[model samples]
Target: MAVVDGEGEAGLLELEDDEPLEDEPEESFDAEVPLAEEPESFGLASARASFR
Candidate 1:
């Protein structure tokens, strides 16, 4: 005697139900924010004195 099963059918249905119909759009950031601000000098005496 031989037996057959359909276990994969249930798994396929579950996967299809879990899938999103449409992808959400990505959010935008502020354009006014400066991205290239120069780093502060730490080793020079003049750089240290400027903070005072």
Candidate 2:
């Protein structure tokens, strides 16, 4: 089994601080990429197949 740890909590705080600066743009790109996959998984199988 995998062990869950407090390191993730620390990382969350760091992200909350970084969010005020360049994190917005960085997250936007990251969000967009996953968003694209999400739609493909939901109903756009054709697009997902193309990407693969």
Candidate 3:
């Protein structure tokens, strides 16, 4: 008959070959990426003039 020590020796050995700790750098966004500009048709200045 085998004895089981409550310390969980078998389970800990399975996770022994894991990855090491290290710092990962952040990702950068380039300014050259094109974005569409808003049109002047829905201008806020003209909308406020109508509310007064």
Q: List the residue pairs that clash in candidate 1.
A: none
- Answer with 1 or 3, whichever has the higher lDDT: 1
lDDT of 3 by residue, 7-42 (tens): 576555534522221121111122322221223434
Better of 2 and 3 by lDDT: 2
**Runs in model 1 with CA error above 4 Å?**
1-6, 20-52
Q: What's the TM-score of each model vs. the native?
A: 0.24, 0.31, 0.21
Candidate 1, residues 1-52, lDDT tens digits: the string is 1223656677666667555522322111223223222232334566778888
Pairs in clash, predicted candidate 3:
none
The residue ranges of model 2 lying beyond 4 angstroms of the native Cα positions read: 1-23, 44-52
A best-first ranking of the candidates according to their TM-score comes to 2, 1, 3
Model 2 agreement with the true structure over 1-52: per-residue lDDT tens digits: 2234856677667767775867479768987999788876777687677899
Q: Positional deviation of 31 in candidate 3, in angstroms?
A: 11
Clashes of 2: 0
Number of the top-ranking candidate, with TM-score as the measure: 2
